[model samples]
Target: MKKKNKSKWLVPVLGLALLAPTVLPTSASATPAKKVTSVEFVGMPAPATAQDMARVYSGASVKVTYDDGTIKSFPLTYKTLFKSTDVINGTPAGVAVDVHGKPIMDRSVPDKPVPFVSDDPDSNSLMKIDGAKPTGLGGNPLSLITHYEYITSDQSGKSAYGIIPASMSLSTIDQNKATGELSVTDVKKVDFSSVGGLWIPCNGSLTPWNTHLSSEEYDADARAYEADPAQTYVSSFTKNYYQDDKKVGNPYAYGYIPEVTVHADHRATVVKHYSMGRFSHELGRVAPDRRTVFFGDDGSNTMMFLYVADKAEDLSAGTLYAAKWIQTSDENGGTANLKWIKLGHATDNEVKAYIDKGIKFSDIFEAADHDTPGFTKIKTYPSGKLEWLKVKPGMEKAAAFLESRRYGAIMGATAEFNKMEGVAVNSKDKKLYVAMSYVEKSMEKDIKGTDASDDIQVKKIKAGVTYEISLEGHQQDKDNNKINSEFVPSLMKGLIVGEDLPKADEKGNTAVVDKVANPDNLSYSESMRTLFIGEDSGMHANNFVWAYNVDTKKLSRILSLPAGAEATGLQSVDHYNGFSYIMSNLQHPGDEMIIPEPLKTEVEGYINQNFDNKRSGLVGYISGLPSLEIKKWKNTNKPDVTLQVAAKANGAKVTWNNKEHTVTVEKGVNKMVLKVGERFVEINGETFELPSEIRVKKGRTTLPADLLDSFFR
Candidate 1:
């Protein structure tokens, strides 16, 4: 069944099912019943005894038999997970790694740089070496990592480098193949001259062609300045650093999506696609066809956009359309019909020509109202306020492409989405998922009367939600409506909802549950058929990354960030050396106490009052399997007998004591002992039965091949 609303909480069931066998009856005759040897489970629980089954973890698995004599089980294994570190060794000149292992200061930061003030280091993309597989950078398949840095600092002030709000950088990680350890070697600033600058580069996606598609958020006013240079600066942060651009009249160059292509040799090239309509872009998801693109506008009362390119993988020339929401009875649950309203179409060069000609973009909207021949208005249902401007003149057409959001508003696109963050496509199911950080009744405010004001009245708010849009049979809509040729918008339904945490107790203690608040970035793993969701919320004490199983409808908390931190860039990798891995980022953690001048005193006072100072912003990987080491018995008599050991966070070291006749498996300070030729192991003098007896081969003691299964679980 579907969930009721975005704020509905999903309480996970915390018990594990007991292992049971299925008995199958013979035919109708009085024959003996046959026993089925299999069992099935939703998620594989940790290896536990009968007493521990009832309190198994949420993601833990269990085995059960159905009445029909069918059995099933999920893959259950521990993995080596990485957490944010406070130290990044070997800092190069001009670059200083923070306690979180993040490169906070790159080459662009002048010597004796101004006090660094930044927040929200979002988006994590890994560019691997040529012919390298996805076994992670530490494995032989992939040995190097190309890391991208996003500084979501929209503060206004002077620094040693110059006045700047937002910036981007690049770094490299050298991995030791033998130890599976990572180290940051070099960090450098990325030149964005081709795109003016990077503004609020948030959660991004790795394209199928192996390129990075970084999105620009909160730059809607670029079009306003391009239309009329007299308009007051929309943002003080950009105004202080980009004053020179305002003087040169190039505000239109900053809002479009930028693409970064990292070569095999580690060099990179950045380009901005002007053809992709400019707005407060959050995420850009390219379809498997490589021509259809879906993007979200991250703000209250914003529009959902679609772009269709003329050629495959070419976004430089395309036709943009905006979605109109048709609400049904289940609107609150994110179920609604959608229709695409054609905004305009143009090439990057064609739109740039109009900007170069000093033509005000606002004039094109004015020209749409005139009784010009061949200019027609496209109608929107209910409120015909949103009518498309059929621009006959070429310049007017150019305006539609340049100022896309403004054109979409005039064309009646629904502005009800609140913080539309990430967009991801599930290629296997042909479904699209969009993350709405949170929804409020104020998002339904009508913008017809106050077109100039960007703020929408806030009345009631709900928690964050993820909407699933079905793309099946969408192509048929082109034939259903001749005017909507080649453009068909599909319906949206809520897939998952986030909830808030309860207040702490008198002692300031709170329960640690698998709850998420603001869902920001989304990613789909084709191999595992799961959706990875990241959070960017201030409402929760700590943000978390959740993994939702599509087929089983089970949501599990995979990772959690530190205090005052948000999770970003939840991506799944399937192309690396036949192994699967997840890449995620923790942005703007609340651990560091460094602050700028004026705010330093205030921040310090607040910290002293609160007595809390913990910050960590890092990029790391999550592997699918635990670290394992296998050694086989040398004697031929010991067929199928071998030694196997696995560790979760690090490799387990095996130590043998010939005189004591004991085999010790050690990871960190935790150790377990198995006596030679024994059928049970000892942990702190507590005995546990093993699956098989230990053995010896070539003067070396060995355990059964699967003896360590319980150790890792």
Candidate 2:
């Protein structure tokens, strides 16, 4: 009877017999080996204990066992073993093991997981182990660029200049919001003639012809006085004081009024358009038709607006309209606002009538405080009753929503807030997102006086996702049906907007009105819903860039820059071949990235707020290139371990250390002098340079090897 199984195991003998065919067929040599594909690790936490097993055993041999009783082993490290986990708390919280016991990861987590060694010897590559290479591209080390000071310093070969103190008085620097002055000395002094005075922080887009369109974020008092048809003499801030007399047409012209500057063909052209409804503009998103453009004014009381150009030649003569929020009752019996305002045709007489009533000529920031002394809302009594009033052409439909204390502090007049900032469109999804930086004054809360005084507002924006214009509006195919665009929604998803809506008053005292942000409240700010408010005081001030989603009436906060850093100009690097850059600047002396006291704390506070919390599928606010191949390398098999080495004349100098065998290189060139402790080697005259792998095995070290040495040498 099956040789009378000698011993009975914890599992049934009958069951074991049944499982033998599937489990016991392989011999020791029948198993396949485990081959490591990649390795990765982060310096977040050290091994908790010897048994933690998370320790990185890179370059350690891994083996796998196969059904044929065979085994294979290969060297592997941290990255290949597991993918990076970006989310702080989510599925596969820290590290997740694959079928073969490897890990996959999410990227939002502040700390990365450590890699573990495979103590077992049965692993090998033929087992079909898969993993990502150690890319070193995902958020390895966080870097921030602030406190800009431009200077010119001379260096050999490449043109170099010392970054020094220089201030630009333009409205927007680099096409972004007005950030304080930082030093960026990349300008060749001789190129001054090509420079436009406006220094928009960010979000400046290139025109169809590749020119920079910088928005006038604010009404420069000096520029208003000089450029106005009826001019009064009021001076604005000036830089390079001595040159004031030398510049033409109010050196200020180059600085104020949103204008377009063309950079191609070697000629600089600047054109300012005053018809686009002045406000704190963050973007000018031209429609696919290229005739209609949408923009958001960043301010406490902002205006979501659109411009329909009257003539293709004169974009400056577009009809401007302010967006109005229309309220609707939701399934929960709660009210929601879902529509924006568009200006229809209003007769010149009607427009003049409102203009005479003190409709202040201003942008988003100014509109928020239309009640201020100099700010006039241009109150008009329609010929008919409020309910019977007609929505005229060239006139925007008024939004039913109003400002609330918990939103944002009123900056100037403090009447109503319209601070809408970042705007982005996803053509595939046909969605748009608007970022609003709403500011509410202090003293709105009921906290203690001391607390109120200590209270500094924190600011941030929201990515308001809305559907793009329907394809039906575009020219139809012969079938007369809309053509589907191949645009898909980006990975960015739901972002909490105004979640930290203010609760305290200016004196740090808690107030009843502060409760307006909650759904349970009946406060005026809570009742109205057209606009999604974002904090613009503390850290919120620095956020830029908003992307939209078409399907969900939700907005995702896709990216952010340093506070006060506007997204002046943005170009998604061509997925094909090209480098994209983001340019930004502050306007005042020493205004660069300086987070004073409460503000500084606010920035850190914003980042650390969710230190231990994790949101599923949250896209990070990353700037610069999403990924880069900064260096490259190639290798070949050689006959001897010590091959004839010669450094090619690529102008690169090579060096290394043999002690710890660690050496870093600064420049890449053809020939070079190298030293290791007391050892020296002239690589120029050799037939082939030493291979890095062999060098490393020989205990030789090199820094930036890919940049300094060519493996083909």
Candidate 3:
């Protein structure tokens, strides 16, 4: 086995942040804001907690009290923007469409997680929120905020959820300017025809430039496509996406990052960042500097990937690096020093050109199942799969980005990480946190430990552990070439580890309760100094969303997902319009798995009673508090959510042009334009940035509430 570098482990200390001040709203309403000291959710009777495995909370609720001891609590709902089953604009609810904007009605998955399948792998795990993008709002309540959300796929085939297409819904949300409470007003699936359609888009993060950066997980094996281009599952995807069985989908296209740009017209355009290496991407999450990105490859035998763009906030071009883990200790979730092997630099179009030229894996590497004379023996992917591979002389760039995992391994980078999931950054601590959902398989020593080929050898944590990568500037790659970005990962060690219960506690519990078990999705609030961890575990009957205060090191259970459901869609916004937001969503619930006996039966009954049709999940936010409150319009005889800015409330005439997808504000001699989906408005065809965009909702034109009082005057 080949080793990338010979660097020993460097011990690193976990630095904790100082406790942040209480987040209290500054609105002078004579009512004092309640600071959240800690939050605890009412856990359902389920496994691990020694509760009934099947029982789930139906009318879930959250109670908030004021500083003066005035108490008020609302039920779990009354705030849900929409369920996966909610149809808007009279369309099919959450229909999964292919590349051509054609619905692939037969794409399905069985309830519960699948161990493994031939081409399709595990589709049932957790639902990731991918973070919510708030448009047209800077900080403070004077500006009403608009939100957009996305949920990606877990590649399921043939079941009740076939229409949901791994299932993605882009819900349009409206935020109460004063309270920071978010509610869904519109929901629709993003069209993907312009960019070869989305392929298994997984989790994502909102870029600092205010765009959505999402992943396409479980990339179809390119080798399989090369052998029988017209007979593989990818071909089927092409048929579904293009609505033509004759169309064979390109394997090179599905694995890269798909960046979504939202326009003022309620439309989105997608572009694939081929510059980012391909694999089972859980995320291509950007660091604070905006130039650096860390990818989570979510499968067994994957490499830890990092990419630094040539320019800040531009992912179209970058130099990629893969980490070679050098173990220093095998105790306490292990410890490692990381050395990066510099992958060749390229732009998006550079690699896409090769892909367009029909570059094959053989074009990049020479591979064999056994030790052929010239082939290098390496175990790079899956749990036990082995390959003898050698990179082609002139195809360096192709090997680096197109067949990245194999190429990284061939170049001697460590490729034994397992179930490497979500990644998040604590800019304050200058640290990066990543989730390894299952610390097993290749992460163990025996997989490829012989030649230091498999450098990570930590005790398996079936319930999982969240690893922290210490970030520092002035670092260099394994070759001692200076790294371009300041956020290079230096030392890595487990920050939050889950413990296992001695045995199953009736409810089929295997992990200790009151602690993190199978930590998955993560988002950090810089102002709050807290890291939110979501779980996708079979060890617990009910998955949970935990808020880990990094400064105080307190693990608080803020919310509990339904029984048999996975906790996902975790994101933290420090402040948007003066109010902070914690974005969250649960994937599929009501599936029977892992739990035993009466618990399963009870859960099945409960699932049938609660889960609407067993296909819908939820997209919502954490409630109760924010830091500021803008006054709401008196709202006399208006809808729960209405376009009630000052102009609309005062009865000003606004016209909507469906053909142009624009809203015209007519005030004699004031011939100007405010466009939707765009944060800018044109005054007499001269464009200028607006604090917020002009949007058309409910067939009516609406300008930012804060703008209404000033723009037209």
Q: Compare the candidates by lDDT and give the number of the best one.
A: 3
Q: Which model is ahead, 1 or 3, in terms of lDDT?
A: 3
* TM, every model: 0.66, 0.40, 0.73
- RMSD of model 3 against the true structure: 15.6
Instruction: List model 3 lDDT by residue over 1-713, tens digit each.
Output: 53223331111111110011211212221122234333222322223332333323223333333343433322332134455555666544455555555445432354553211111111111111234444344212111111111223334533321112343445455554322445455555667666676666657777887677777777777776687774444665666557676765678877878877765544556788999988888887788898999988988888999999999988999998999999987765778999999988999999999988878766777777766887877766532366677887998898889878877887778988888898989998899999988888778878534532767778878888898999999999988899998899989998898888889876666998677898888888775567888888888767877777786676766676667777666667654433445666666675546667665766667665555535566655665431211122221232222333544665555666677666665444333345567544433222233334455567655544333333344
Decoy 1 TM-score against native: 0.66
lDDT scores in order:
0.52, 0.26, 0.62
lDDT of 2 by residue, 327-418 (tens): 23211111223222323322223433332343322211223222345432321111001111112233331111111111111111121223
Angstrom error at residue 292, model 3: 0.5
Best first by TM-score, ranked = 3, 1, 2
lDDT of 3 at 280: 83
Deviation (Å) of 649 in candidate 2: 10
Instruction: Give the residue spans of candidate 1 off by over 4 A.
Output: 1-117, 129-165, 175-182, 222-249, 367-394, 442-461, 473-489, 500-514, 591-616, 624-713
